[model samples]
Every structure is written in C-alpha cells, then in structure tokens.
Target: MFLDASGSAPMTNRTLEAFQAGLADGWADPTRLHTESRRARQLLDASREAFAEALGSRPEHTHLAHSPHAALERVIAGIFTARRGRDRIVASAVERDATLHAATHVAAGHVSSVPVDPRGHVDLEALARELAVPDVALAAIQHANHEIGTVQRLADVAALTVAAQVPLLVDATASIGHGPSPAHWDALVANPADWGGPAGLGIVALRPQTRWLPAWPEGDDWAPGGVLVPAVLAAAVALQERREQLDATSLRLHRMVGRVRDAAAAWPGVDVVGDPDERLPHVVTFSCLYVDGEALLTRLDREGIAVGSGSACTTSTLEPSRVLAAVGALSHGNVRLGLHPGVTDADIDRLLALMPRVISDLRAEAGAPEVA
Candidate 1:
C-alpha cells in the first residue's frame, strides 16, 4: 500500500538480474588496463551507449555520477565556470535546493529567481526579461516539477534563452522516464531511480556545443573517482525496460491520477494543486485545511498507506512547501501522490475510500470548523 513513489522506485527483477551480473563481470576498475579491467570497461561503455539512447543523445555527451544531486551541483558549477565573464544565473523560484545552492555558490549570490504562476508554470515573460539581462551565464529549469508535476513550457523557455545567447541547463530528473525525451536543452541531469533503476547512479549529459568547462580536477573530471560499473549497467537496463512500457504505463497512470484528484477535490477545504491537464502522468498533490501535514501523514501511514508530504526534497520537517507557497496554494495538510507503475486500481479505490474519514477525523481532533 506504499504510494509515495516519487523520488525512488523499486527495481524490477530483470534490472536486479542485470545488476547482479554486472557485479560479477564489472567489478574491476574500468580505468586500469588489465584483462578484467578491459571487460569492465566494455560493460561501462555499453551502459553509457544504452543510456544515451534513452536520452536521445550520444555516448560521448553522457557521463555517470554518484547521484542525481551531485550531478546537478557539478553541471551548474561547470557551466558557470566556463562562462566566468557572465556572473548572474537565472532560475525558477520552484527549483530544487540543489540547483539553487549550486547556482548561488558559483554566481556569488548573483542568482535571479523567476516566479511561477498558480499552476506551477514558470513566468515566461519574467524569464525572458531575466535572460535578456547582461552578464547572464546560464538558466536552469526542470522539465517537470518534482512536487506538483507541472510541466514547464520548455520549448518556449529554450527559445528565450537561445535568443539571449544564454546556455540552458535543464533538470530532467522528474520527466526523463515518464515522458518524451526533452528536445531542447544544452545540459541536462536525470535520476536513474526515477525510472525504477538504481538510485546510486545518475545520468548527466551535455550537448556537444554547450560551453561547459570541467568543474573537477583533471584526470577524472566528470566523475572524480570514476563511476560504479554495476550500478550504471543496472540503470541503463532499467531505463530501456521503462521506455518499452512508457506509452501504456503513462496512459494508465494518468487516468489513475485523475481519479485520485477527483476524489480528493470532493473533500471540503481541500485544494488540489498543479495543472489538471499539463502535468506529469504519475504525480498529484493536494492540501487540506484544518489539518497538520505531519499528522495527516502519520494517520495515512497507520492506515497502511504511504505518501509524501510538504516539499518533495525537504520532507524531513513538516515545514510549508515552497512550491505550494509560490502557486498561492494551501500549504498545510499536504499529500503528494507519485503513482508507481505497480499500483493497481484497487489500491487507488482503497485510498479514495478511506480519505474522507481520515480528513474528517483529523479536523475533529484539531477542533477546526468545517469550511464547507
């Protein structure tokens, strides 16, 4: 009954098998020149190629990283260094802390945060104006929001950046596996875990023409100590498998998400967030009045259902969600549903059937009046 399938997913049996095989065959250091090393290198190379195919890019443009957060930090810093003459970075208000922190570090607090509308879509005119500013290095935007699942107008944003002669770095962590390949990005970061692969590995790719300098020391610039061969292989296999089932899985999950939204919206004082039509197929979020987020989360857990609360990245505390605040949505009693492909219709029905009681009971405990 686990429903919080956002940031990570359970690896499939086939992917696990590939990982086990990689452990045996790819244990050697890929940088070495010995027989075992060459075998490991072959596996690593093949994995890179397969992953590139998934991204619609070439192997030469792709590199493996320890994790998605690390990849994001590295990519932003690298591009900022290459465009040293340009000191300012433009990014959306709803970007992950990882992106914002890296941008701040490189730009020395010269980052401009663009606003998003109530639907979580970035303000294109504001973004265009910011990009048009002088000394602008690069702009970072996620292909889709990790929390509310709002898909940005990426092509429009890309056009703005291109016109301003600024490089575009896209955080594709949420959309890579669940949607179509991004057609316009100079640099990109993706999470293998988002596609039911190994969370230990990350995929970072740069367009050949992107003016990105190496952020790390020489020798192992992209990956400081190289990457985990088995993990990379497992990630590649998982992405390929997900791609094969993408069309059908996306449609099924979208319908399920719509059902969840409909059920949740029926509750009084409930505010369902995100664009109803232009959002990711597997994610939906809602905020309930007269309830504490942590209390709601704990109650759901007791009911044998698991879901995310508050910010997708900063769920450690029940602090209000930045994404919700940006969209002018209710921030309390938040529940984010990231529908895993394995979740069946019965699971959704059970969740929907119990939600009303849960909300009402929590409200009673808080002594809050019904909002009608």
Candidate 2:
C-alpha cells in the first residue's frame, strides 16, 4: 500500500513504453534540418497539440517545459519582468514551495500573501482587497492544496481578479488530472508526474491574449531546443485517461478519502485537516498530537504500508509545515494521505486499520500521555 501519490505517482506500463520509444526516436534535435530531426519535430509538434487539448487550451497557447519547477519559476519570473509597472504579487499562503519561492524571488518585499482560514481556504475578502491595489502585478494561487486537499473558490476569485484587472497564474499541479480543468485562469501550469506521466515534462498554457513576456527570444519560446516528446505524449494519454475515468474515479476515491477522514477523526489526538467536502477526492490530511510524524511513518512502513508526512521533525529542520502553520494546524505529526487509481479497497482498509494503532503506539513510545 504505497499511498504517497502527492509526491510522485507510479508510471503506467504504457507510459514506460512511450518513454522508451521517445528515447529511441525522439533523440534527434528537432531544429536541425535533417530527416531524423524532421521525424522528431513531427512528434514534438503533435504532442504539443495533444497537450493543449488535454488542458482545454488552444494549441498555439501551450508549451512544454523540461520540469515543473523550471516551468513555474521561469513563467513567474518572466511575467513579473514583463509587467514592470505592477509592483506586487498576491498569493495564498498555502501554495506549493516552488510557487511561493518564485513569488518571493520575483516580487521580493512587494510579495503580499493572503492568509487562509482554519479550513485551509484562502481569504477571499483579503484577496479582493489585495488585488484592488493598482500596483498589484499578478495573482498566484494553486488550484488545490496538495498537502491539505483544499480546493479554493476559484471562479469567485477569478471574478475578483477580473474586476481588479490582475492576471492570474494558477498552479494546477495537484488538481489537473484529479478533477475538472481550472478554467478562466490567465495562465496555468502542471506536472506530468502528478497524473502518472513521466516526471521530465511540465505543461504550461497561456491564454492567447494573456499578458506574458517571455524571458527569451520568441524563436526559442519554451527553450533553446525541443522538450521530451515521449513524456509529452505520455502526459497527453494520461490526461485523456484521467478525464474518461474522472467521475467514477472521483466517486470511488471520495468514498475512500471519506473513510480515511472518518477513521482519523475518531482516533485520539488526531485532527483531520482540510475542507471535508470541497476538497480533492484523493487527498486527506491529519495531525496527531504528542506523536512524532516520522516515527509513525517508520512504524507504518514496517507494516508494508507507505505514507507521507508533514512534520517539523521530518522536513528540512525542526520547523513545521508552512501550510499547516498558515492554517493554524498542529503542524507536528502531520501526515498527508494521497490516493491514486492504483489504490484499492483493500489498501484503504489496510491504511485505516494501521493508522490509529501506529499513531497511538508512537505516542506511547514518546512517553506522551494518551488522549481519549
């Protein structure tokens, strides 16, 4: 039971085959004037359209980057540079690390963050107030919180952005394949790995009329050379598959996540986090008091069940998660459980049975008094 889909997903067999084929046939430089190059170009061009269509954008507006981190960083910096007059960026506090880092790098001291509620939802009123500032450069927010599974009120926020005439950059990294397209954002970015594609590719779509300035020349739009064609094809295929199974997968995963929420909530010293209803169907997070998150993970791993955690003890330092901190969560002994298509009812049952016992055991081991 490997339940860490939020970190990285296991590639399907088709995805591996697609990647192997890309290595064999797409190795040539697409920009070269040769037969092999021509073939590579064909694959690259084809995948571009497929990727755009998958994200509900026009072919002309999409570009594939080498990695999601590079895509988000460059896009954020490029847009920030182009919109020189706009001096500030407004983002929710709970965005992924890459987005928050880019926001800080691009806007520095001018970066203003909108706080989230205890439920991990962005403060819409505060966002509106921030966006109303004429000097606001852009608004950056995630389509969903990967850690907490909180889905923002996007359409309402988009309307506020429109009224304020601020461009929106949405990090759809976690939500793209898990649910519906986050439409109406001026720009969007997601990782192929998030949806069971290869980790090498990142998808970016900028609306045709969206105000964005490329840091490089127009001729070398995405990069100096072609991207990973095989990864792009695999991403497109994965996206189509995700859409086809979206409703059913959503219903099934939502039920499983509900089971997790119910079990974790009932356990002593564990607090279920995120919006129980308006959240990602595959993700549920909880914090256990008086237990070290890493110890719980190790204990669970020994039982052949792997999960993810977000504790100060597990992260870089003894610092708690900024996400949990932003939402007033305990931040110690926090675990984020993200499910995928690979997960079965048995896996859910295993997790439910293992979670409470390990958490309680870890608490006891740490010499902490147990709660009811």
Q: Which 10-residue span in candidate 1 carries the lowest summed lDDT?
A: 311-320
Candidate 1 regions with alpha-carbon error over 4 angstroms: 311-318
Clash pairs, candidate 2, are none
- TM-score, cand. 2: 0.96
10 residues in a row with least lDDT, candidate 2: 217-226
Question: Of the candidates shown, which would achieve the greatest lDDT relative to the real structure?
Answer: 1
Clashes of each: 0, 0
lDDT of 2 at 250: 86
Model 1, CA-based lDDT: 0.88
| Candidate 2 residue lDDT tens string, 1-372 | 788898477877777777778878878878889999888887777877877876888888887788888788877877787788887989899988888888888788998989999998889999998987799888998889989999998998899998998889999988888888888798899888888887877778888777677766654366546577667767777766777899999899999999999988989888899999999989888999998888878888888887888889897788888889999988888888888888999999878877777877788888998598
